[model samples]
Target: MNFNPVEILGLIAAVFTTSAFLPQVYKTWRSRSAKNLSLTMYLVFFTGVMMWMVYGFLIDSLAVILANIVTGFLTLILIYFKIRYKD
Candidate 1:
């Protein structure tokens, strides 16, 4: 297998940024506090992710498609928890 530098960077960035949400998710699950979270931000974030997904579709970029797909779900779950357990 061969790794291009840019692709490696993309993969690294994708992993780091995507994994950033894990702690938030775990903490939220443990404490069930959504007050500090922003509803409007998540709504806009979800919309932006959806748009990224669509843009990926239009451009046919695998990296863009994959990252956005995973991030989108992660974001959606947080949003759901935010709604379900808002303070």
Candidate 2:
């Protein structure tokens, strides 16, 4: 209810970070090609995102929780596509 500058900044940052993955997600989904993606990098990143979500919960950070949840789902989809389309 109270306005917090830090929380506002966090939400703004979350928007940018979460949206950064949209291009890759769209490309992979539309082309069904993930040959250029790194499975290891995604796995690590997803794990980190999940951890960030947990950390967000522990800290009661709504922006972090929401952003990571969406990001994690997108990352998981990429991971799935990577495995499914592997040559």
Candidate 3:
């Protein structure tokens, strides 16, 4: 599969955006504290990401699809943590 420069850029952007949640996930997991996290916000964000993933699939965009896949998983984990570690 050949990728254009634009696609390459999208991949790079995707990496940054998707990895941005790592620190929060790690902190929440390690601290076992999700009291500060907003369930509403994460729920909305997860919904949006799922929509974006669908859009990506519709458009046949690998970067968007991959990024959303990872982001969705991370968001789900955070949601689980929030529910499981409720204060």
Error of 1 at 64 (Å): 1.5
Q: Model 3: residues >4 Å from true position, as ranges? A: none
Candidate 2 residue pairs in clash (backbone atoms < 3 Å): none
Q: Tell me how many clashing residue pairs each candidate has.
A: 0, 0, 0
Higher-TM-score candidate of 1 and 3: 3
Candidates ranked by TM-score, best first?
A: 3, 2, 1
CA lDDT of each candidate? 0.82, 0.90, 0.94
Point out where model 2 deviates above 4 Å.
1-3
Candidate of highest TM-score: 3
Error of 3 at 73 (Å): 0.3
Question: Pairing residues by index, what is the TM-score of model 2?
Answer: 0.89
What overall lDDT, based on C-alpha atoms, would model 3 receive against the true structure?
0.94
For 1-87, candidate 2 gives per-residue lDDT tens digits of 223998888888888988989999889989989999999999999999999999999989988898899899989989999999885
Across 31-81, the per-residue lDDT of candidate 3 in tens digits comes to: 999999999999999999999999988888898999999999999999999
Model 3, residue 63: what's the lDDT?
Answer: 89
- Quote the lDDT for 29 in model 2: 84
